[model samples]
Target: MMRKIENALAVALIAIVAVLPLFLKFMQGVCRVQVPGADIAVLHFVFLFASVAGLVTWREDRHLSLASLSSVFGEKIRRPIESVKTGGASCILSALFINAFCQLVNPAQFDARFWGMSVRFFFASLPLCYFGIIAMISCKKGNLIASLIGMVFGLFISMGPFTGILYYLFGMENVPSLYAINDAWLSFSKIALLPIIVIFSSLAFFGMPLFLVLGGIAYVLFSAGGGYVDVIPLETYRILTDRNIAAIPLFTIAGYILSQSSAGSRYVAVFKSLIGPFRGGTVIAAVIVSTFFSTFTGVSGITILALGPLLAVVLTGSGYSKDRAESLVTASGAIGLLFPPSAAIIMYATVNYFSIDVFDLFKGAIIPGCIMALSMMATGVVLDKRGERPKFSGKEARDAVLHCIPELLMPAFISVLYFKGVFDLFEAAAFAVIYAFCLSVFVRRDFTLKKSARVVASSVPVSGGVLFILGAASGISYFMLDANVPAILSGFITQYVKNPYVFLILMNLVLLVVGCLMDMFSAILIVSPLLLPLAESFGVSAVRAAVIFLMNLSIGFLTPPVGMDLFISSYTFDKPLSRVVKGILPFLIVQFAVLMLVTYVPFFTEAFL
Candidate 1:
């Protein structure tokens, strides 16, 4: 019965919204109303009234006990009452006096000032929306009612008048001085509300679909009756040049195709054959294979899936335990995220407004990548030392190398292109795709047209997912700039940390925390604009700063709570997320430590530059 009611309500709501424009137009034509913005004004008022009523009802139902007010009274009830009455009466009297003074001084001024109430109401309602959602999710009583209240608040807060005030304040000259105001506003809207969305979506199961519908509605309303709100001047050549973004999808496709080819399997097989003879050898093999694959694919999920089954086979065949095999596979999987040709690296470079030569980024990453790989290998050696070591015959070793040669050549081909500069990212990626196709069709005979098409089709969703997030983040970026977020942040940072090193450390800490919660791409896109100017002020190279920022955010994939890679690893290993997290701990530590080094020691990135 409840389900049927909910569905009926949803359908009715959709129908009403769809027919609203026509209904309003008809009413206006028949009545001949002279109001220029009546539609927008009515929409705002309805939302505002709904939001206030819902919030008040919600708070009344969840009212705190009178005993809970004892702390404020402290055994002096009369005094507390006296204080409340006095404060309230004084506020009301003061408001009246101010209105009287304004009317006497200048009636036009008073009317203009009073008209600004709509803007103030709009701003005040934003926090109410956010808090209502948080309360809905976290509080125990009547989540549905609380959510409804939140929805009302969101509708009101997102109305035209509020948006207009936001545009005005943020659009002012010298608005950068109000970075704190911008930051605080964004913290409430973007940061706070986003987590609430995540929590509700995860917990309610049905919540995500509803959230998506609400989001679509909100977007439509916000964009309605728009008369060219030019928040940022578009860069002419920069926006038109698809070349800048071409590398992103091309590299993504190359990685996908490489994973689908025999190269991926062969690379896994060779590592197992070569290292299968020693104690913990299979684990070591997994690490080596992960490292090699990272050079070509630079994706942790693909690397893990490619090597996982083979590593499991080798480990079990060598008499190692399942627990040990799972640990090795999980840790090795994490290495690809930190290695070269990583999509995360591409995103970071783009967001920071500097191009990172894939070769330089790749070469610079080698040492740090090795540090992580070696750390995992060392951990495996200690963990699986007691297992029996299998010995392979000379023929077996020879065959392993022969089988692996073709797969091994792909990374070599990529490195050669990087060094020759024949393909500056986009061209190289196109070349790689062609090479992979040729290798699969003629040389390897493993890739069929059907299979190739399937592989290419599968990559679309992955690429689309990243691109969609980038677009949404662009909207959020527009909002932040409109609020003068960057200027306010710059002022705060300059006040406390004048020294470059201290500023770098502070930025690192901030990135580290942000990374743990958000995906690397979104984090870089949202954060780089704010932090890049600070880095420039401190005499830091934009390229180096970008690299460091990316490297730190990449670690988020391995951390808990929101780690996308960690979830992938858990699925690959068929282990609980907690277990996978535990296995990747050592690698996480090593990667974060390396991030600190790369951030402070500019020479690490500068050597090739």
Candidate 2:
């Protein structure tokens, strides 16, 4: 019953938020409420509600339990509540108090001092509160440490100098209604009350929807109340026409479709057959296959997921040690970062206000990619010196090549179309999709209309998730531009390093670090705007800068913690992350060395440009 209510509420809330503007306009026409910027108000409401709904859904789905009053209050004689009903009431009251306090505080003084301090306060307060709550709930809970870690994350989101930088960039005047509360009471009300509403509302299916509706109302009220409001004029839409920008989704879709096709599997088979006979051949096969497929796919997750199993079979069959095989594939999985049609590259290009020929980028990446692959092969050889390398017969090789013919043609077809100007990026992508569909249905005889529809549906989520992030990043970029962040960053870099070469190297290192910590798409969107202009100031070719940025980000997938490729490989091989990292160190070093080469020698990328 609770779940059903939650579901209904969630749906209702989404609908309300989506239609808020139209409703508001109608209300204004019918009776003058004198609402200012109804569209902006509607947007603010939608953003907040969406955020709350997403948070609630995530929490519920994860079964993230909260702590008990006793744990949080340290076994006080006066227990707050035994049931969720009482607990929720207490939360509402507490949030109300916080909100009142925030509202009563002076906006000007808070802006002067607490504005900057709010980020730290949020980090310090929210996590501690959550931890205390969680600790009070269940004694057997093991997530206390995880919650504490999340506090650190909260700090990154809230208190960091970077946060201030971002806030300033996004246009301090244009902060959303919910986020723009100036009075301490209002601020507290928004922060505390909003989260509580989300949690309680999520308790029932309808809760999320209700919360969204309330959030929309709050946005309307806040915006009408008039704190700070600035909306980009529609003229800014012209920036979308930049040729390179169009390549992003095209490349992304191409990569997605290729991964979905049998071509992905056949590519793996060919790599295995060719390299399986050599010493540490399976590892080599993994590296080769990953590298080759990455050219068209450009996604580390898809590449690793698709190729990991195939490589594993070849490696084990070729007499390589299991550890060596696992480590080799894991290391090779990083190739997706360097290949063309890469999300990283597309993202970097989009953010930097430029584009590179995907084919040209592929050519430039070959040397560096080869270096990483060879390094992986060397590591496998060293690790399994005694293992017998499998031998491939002529017949076996012939059959393997023949099996991969359909798959092999995909890259060639894409490259030819792109180079011949047969179609723009989107049109080329459409062609690729059509080609894949034909191959799957006619050649492979494996695809039904229903199956194809499912595949397309599955791909939508993947595409949507990425595009959503892009939109958010764009929003953040808008904010940053308003703040003059690019100018400030450029000034700082120029002051510190006058030499272009030194500056480029420094930028590479920074991007590498950022890539290791953040998702490639988000990182590109966030960092590229500030850094790209700086590169241009130093007379760096836009294409060269983009290539360097892509390479650095690609290397990031091999690093610890946030490395998506490492995570995929670890899961595929069922090996500890630490072991995989250790085994991949040699490959990492070689890749980094290649990155440095690309950074210093402009010719590596610029020759083609």
Candidate 3:
């Protein structure tokens, strides 16, 4: 019952937030609730979210347990409560000590009277911190009163002190609902930024969403800049408005159709029929099929899940060792990442500031992607010396091609639709969904309407989750851009690194570690923004930089200790994680070599661009 409620509330929250932009426009244009210079949209989000929190808080039958809620949040909200306690206390002390040191450095550096101001301000805000911690912890365990408190806190903080009252009381004083930015708040907020970053970063380490940290950073920076808190909501509105943005969900639905259908089998058959007669033929077929199939799913694990057993049989049966076969195929699983219409590239491009033609970006990645794919297969060909080459029959080849035509032509069809100017990306995506629907229902008949419906429904959370993160993270982008974070970051890095080669080398090493730690989606959203300016300073084009960055993270799948595909591969093959790590090491080394080459030789990507 609680699970049902949480799902319902989460779905409602996403559905409502998805359409909030239109609602905001209506309030401003038709209802006229917006003040001339103030943002009523932010207030609306505050209220709407509070309302959702209320719904999540409600117990229809007096059933209560926050465990369901915690599971619903997974790791995303788990650490915020505890971290806020320890981190908040540390923040207060650090500010006190730092302020004292600064006071000694030069009494005239700042207002000498304001030496211990940050520490004093922290004490004042300690109650709010306690309120937040209790609210989060209580929400985690499903406390009705705590959820209500959270709702109240949301309303109060969003409205601050000014906008909640004074609407009809004294309405005529130059945008009277306007909550003026307090300067003392600004100075103290700026002082608070360091501790805020450290605390949030700590939460992030515990698996909290980076967006929360980013949002906190945005709030403080916006406060310091005298900007409205509404910018976060407003940027979210802007992200949703982009035409390319709608393509994400459409393609996601389309991908699920193929992944859930017989497309994987058909793809494997086609490759086998065509290439099963050569030396190292099975290895080639496995690489090609896995690469092509994973593009639709945008998940490396799906390759292992759907085709791991078949590929394993083919490779081991072809005289390859079990560990070698498993390792090689697992490494090849992520080769789809660089292919066109891989959903993630769109996410990267959507949030990016540069102008990237999706097709053009697709064109740029072809060579780099192929290099990684070929390199994985090449390593296999060198290691495995197989003697059996099956004689190919023309009838079987024809049958296989005929069976695979729809799946095989998908990328080319979508590319033509997108690149040839025949349709907008959204239309292309819609057509892809429609095409997949036709294949799944009428031609392939892999699932009935009910099953297909479930497939589409399952994809909603993925789409919704990604969109939520994008929206929340946009606030940080706004704040960082406003705060000159990119400039400051580049300035600081160049001050120490000096050589562009050294910077590039460090970027490769650091990103490999990052990839091993976080999923690609989170890493790209959180890390890419920071890396972009630094890469540009080193004179890398956005396309090349993106390719390099993605490729490294792609290889990060083969890394140990929570690499996304490593766990999946372990489960798929019924191997323990330690064995999985050992099996994957050689292929990982080769991928790192490819990564280094891609990093240094911009020509691989540049040639296609």
Candidate 4:
């Protein structure tokens, strides 16, 4: 089946991506031999890895999208809407596929080959992968007519590229009629672009994949504005090939490997042994472990779901109330976003590259990140005020620390290698992957080959999904830039919200709402461009603004109603949503206080800088 093939390809690609970096590092570091075009090869593999993984994610129905409306509606009513969304997605992807193919055959496009693979192969693979997606959609939904209808619309959207292919195969003079039809379609698309975007915006709530929703809007905006829709794919290619962007997948895999191994338990043991004698020591361990896990994974939901139960037991056994423990665990999930090597900060800098420096943002985040983490721990301690606690054993502490030293040394390894200029961001990420692999597989020997495969199978989809959204959202950001939306927004903000302090407060409120609605990755991609300029207009430094943006979204994970952590914690603990919400209330208040301090004071985030 196509599904199985996609999954297999995803796993293989991820394995290669994981190993390729380590090999390259060895060639550079150990052998003192640099591989020519090594960076290019890594970026290409990352691209292929992301593409294949994204398709697998789609096949698995795991692409991130808002589906609250689907939950609200019954299956009978929701089924039709889902079918229509699928068809719409088919249309957008089909157009993109055609566009990619046209680019492949174009005389002007890049034709260089690397590692015996034509660059055109990358372009060529797009159509096949996209067509496969289309086929899989029909196969999964059993809706052939919908796909056919969608393809026709796709042709219309891709009229420019479709006609180019015709001209390249046959002279434009001979295809005068085709050119005329293309012009007519372009005119109609121009008139219809606004309405189409509106419909896609509405469909976002109806469970449309975020990539399709974003890609659709970008494609039409480009097409109607006398720009080539094919450029959207080109832009996607450009982002995926960026020097530092590959680090996202590399670091993500590293985090996944560690999470899948026995790292969490070892960390808990170490934290407990070191702090277990103090009052509220277990609560402190729970917060520390949660923060540590989330710092690597960059996904709070994963932190809560994977380690929540274990931490719950640890906390409950230490005399903490179940409600208080659950609340602390959920709130601690995302407090690590401001820490070093955080994918969120990397993404934030990448998106706002013109203004923000990755190193500066990383440095800026440390103090604020610690404040948030410590605040959560302090709140946990306060909530669980029982005085009796276990006595510390130096021998036990030494054993626990010895066991987790490699795990603890990970942060230090990354910091020394990267900050000291021994490795680039991409190389550092690759090193983290290699380090985690060795620690998990060889050092601990707890991660078996089969488990490694399973981790690859599990983590690739997440990396793919996040990368897919990042790539697609880049198109929207491109359109916004081309439209000068950021400048316009800056002018509006300058006129309306004059006070810098007032703007910071307002920005936090807005981001909290956006966080409640959108995933952090897409939010960073689509929102940062519009926000960065406004922050600058208000005299806020880029590093400080970046920290504020990320911290707000971090706390957004714990915000009420639809905060991601609330749902994950509820499910993980088997508690009602209301109970989870009630439990997290105090931690939320604490995080909000920290957020406000970071937002207003600025020194916390700017201390290192």
Candidate 5:
């Protein structure tokens, strides 16, 4: 039943993304559905909104707590105010679209400022609409009325009726500083910010989806700061629609295609032949294969979700316990982030608000990445000491090598094209898609045209979910930057911690905490900026700083309590979270050891650079 639902969802996402290249032409002014007041009517904006709405609804449960609005949140908020479904999102989206369209057609009174405000209001309401729509669509009649009442209250707040009355009472229209005129409102918003943060923070505490929580807090903070409401959707549209970032989804699809085919097994077979008669050949094979996918795909979860089961079976079949096998696979899952062309690394470079070259960072990652992979391999050898070495056959080795050639050569193919400037990252991604398609469909005969569609269908949602988080996260990032929050935090850190060693330790702890709270991609966006300044104060190179920061985030994915990879491992192996936690401890300890080495040994990152 779940598989059927997932298949249906994948098909829908593919259809939506398929519309992008065609509809994006409209975004560039080559095509548009002209409404009256608005000159730029981007159809792709509507498509993206619909895509985001669907992704949030499909991926998360539809529910909220009334008590979340009050001071009480822990257990009291457990009882959902109401549950929602897809229809709820559609209703709110319909409202947003209709209201936006109506404003574009004929904004009330036609004043230019009012027209702009109306448009800004439409875009600003997007994040809130995620909840507001759900509230309206709850099955209960009371929920419907409550949602409407909340909407009314929101509208009143937006208009500032109280501010207008206070201004009239004070006769402050002629004030030199405009801020002095609306003094009461500004003070109140600032004063109320603490509670406002607390209220929204609970939404995240209760698992209101990180993307929504990030965007929601940004919205609330921006509103309090008297910022342009349009920043919310504008940042959403900008970060998501970047041409370079398109490589993420393409590479993810390629990785998934290889995973779902014979490619993974072939990879393992080739590694087995090379390691011939080793005590832990199979464990090495699983780690190497996982590294290949995680490097290109950029999400450790993909490696586990696609390859963990097969690797688990191979390890257990080779006389390792099931728990041990699961633990090995789980720990090795996130090592891909240490490699070049890492989605996390690229995103860190792109969003860091600095001028760091992608290639330079790629150059710096090699040694540390190797250390991580080797640590896992050594751990595997030590943990399972029983020597049941497979007999090495030259014929079998030759056959395995022959079978793996086409896929194994992928990194070189991508590197020469990318490094030699024959193609950019997105073009390399395009080539990768084409290359993987041929390898699977023709050379390997692992998939035909019909079978390939199933591969694509399964892969599209991963891309959608990832891309959606990036889109929403940008708004959160902008809010922090605009508030000079990073500068303030950096100053605070530098003021207290002068030692680079102490700072690095604190940095690791902070990143680990952040990793447990959000996805690594989102973590890079929000946290990297605050910490990077200390790199200069502590006299570290940009490449080393980035590696230190990203590497910690990589390990954070393995960190317990809410590490994203732990959950992925649990779901993949059908193990309870606690068991996965217990299973991964020794591996986690080894990860920490390597992390300490990478932290102290400047040679590991700087040598290649």
Candidate 6:
């Protein structure tokens, strides 16, 4: 019953938030009237969406975490490690719940109103959902006793604020003993801060969810240093409620809607029909089609999974070797990341500490994006052993193009609408969702109502996973800024590295490792702030640094050993990991060359801006 309620509320909240921008735009432009509290409503709905969706994903065990470090071990060892990780995560969530409850019941917030609606009404979800997530995690892991003890531990640690709130609500006399306990806990936590962080870091490798790990770390740091612990949740609230952040989830839904439909096959037909007549054309078509989907899906793994099989067959049937064809598909997975309407670029501009125009960032990425895409295609062409291709069929090409015209026009539609001032970024994203919905459900009739709901339902967990990470990462970023880590690192770097070119080389190498470790969004939020200062000290423009950062990370997806693309491609193609890595080597070399060119030659990323 509780799960049903959570799901219903999550879907309703997501639906409302998803349509708000389009609804608000319709009112302003078509209805010619302002909507009261429109901005506040949108922001709060995003908050609710983030929390509820996160809670739902948490319940579903869909939140992102590193693969369990104990996966290779026996159950005897792995089970205990997993139990400890779950207990730690539950305690962290419990602490967060207590923190949010204090914020919720604050005397100042009781009278807060957005137009006629009480803000506390929405704020109520924060604590409720956090508590719910904790309960769900404990139950699923079969660690109820351990999690309960951890919850008690969390409350003990937070006793200073927790008891203070209770005293106000109950009009109790001063509790000297409770305050003493709080003080003692704080003293111990402060003294053992490094050990606690080390334990938590180890849990992260053991598969504690990333948000909980980061949030837990921030919670400890603040409490030990006598900083406000409530600010941790506030940082989450701030990042999730930002105007541009809305687009991440919105575009995410749009991407999933199209991917879940028949659009992939249609677009594949269009690309193949247009290019299949020439030598090496099948490989080129594979690259284009993969790039097109990656631009929408934002995660290249999805692109590889959705279209990898069909394209592999297409390439193999067209006479190319399976390994090379599969590698080309994997290599193309991360290419279109630098294109317009890319969620990564939007996220970079949004989270970047130094001021950056998203438009300028997108502009800067175009030539580099084209270079990466063209280079992959050219490499495939050079490596091809396929001889003369079939002659072009005008009728076949026309029909294929006509069939997928809506999919083909999607990028152009979004760009023109956003760039021409027809819609702001959020509205553009909202329009993309609505447009994809219409194409897939109404026009193409690819999804029934029930299926459409399921597709949107599936997307919520992914959106929640990404949004939750961004929110928690902001807390870590906040702690870093408060500690002045960036300035310290920047000063240290400038003193040692006398040449800008040398700094660029080291930055590139650092980002490649970082990219292999975390998702692009989290990397952008957590690392960009630290690096931007260093880049500025070396005279690299913010736009150039961003391009360099994104370009390197894109290639990082193709890096060997543990590159995400290698794993996904191996899974999709049912090939050994070694073979997948070997298959991508040629394309990886080509991308490395392009990366070096983009790093040193600024014109490709800078000329458009």
Tell me model 3's lDDT, rounded to 2 decimals: 0.63
lDDT of 5 by residue, 409-448 (tens): 9878988988897666666666777677788999889988
Please write out the lDDT profile of model 3 over residues 307-397, one tens digit for every residue. 7887888778777889888887798888988987776677677666474556666777889999999998788777767766779888999
Per-residue lDDT, model 2, residue 588, is: 76
Model 2, span 483-517: residue lDDT tens? 68889999988888899978887888788887675
lDDT against true structure, model 2: 0.53
Clashes of each: 1, 30, 1, 0, 0, 0
Residue range 1-609, candidate 4, lDDT tens digits: 866676677777766766787788889899999888777787787788777877778777778776457777888997787678777988998888888777877878857778877777765665676777888887764677777888888887687888788767665646676677677867877999889889988888887888888888888888778756767878888888887778887887888788778998898899999997887678889888888778777778878877888888888888888888777888888977788678898888888888989999989999998998888878776776777777889999999999888899998989899999988888888888878888888889987876776776778767878888888888888888888999998998888877898898899999999888788988898898999889988889999888898988888877888887787788899988899988888878888998888888878877878
- lDDT per residue (tens digit) for residues 157-258 in model 1: 333323333444454334443444433444454435555445433322221222122222223222331412121111111221234343454565566677
Q: Quote the RMSD, in angstroms, for model 3.
A: 11.7
> How do the predictions measure up, each by TM-score?
0.61, 0.62, 0.72, 0.95, 0.79, 0.96
The TM-score obtained by model 5 is 0.79
Q: What is the C-alpha local distance difference test score of candidate 6? A: 0.84
Clashing pairs in 4: none
Ranking of predictions according to TM-score: 6, 4, 5, 3, 2, 1
What TM-score does prediction 3 earn?
A: 0.72
Q: What is the lDDT of residue 80 in candidate 3?
A: 51
Q: lDDT per prediction?
A: 0.53, 0.53, 0.63, 0.82, 0.67, 0.84
Give the lDDT of residue 598 in candidate 1. 76
Off by over 4 Å in 2: 1-261, 354-387, 499-502
Winning model by TM-score: 6
Residue pairs with colliding backbones in model 5 are: none
Root-mean-square deviation per candidate: 16.7, 13.8, 11.7, 2.1, 7.7, 1.9
Looking at model 6, residue 92 earns an lDDT score of 88
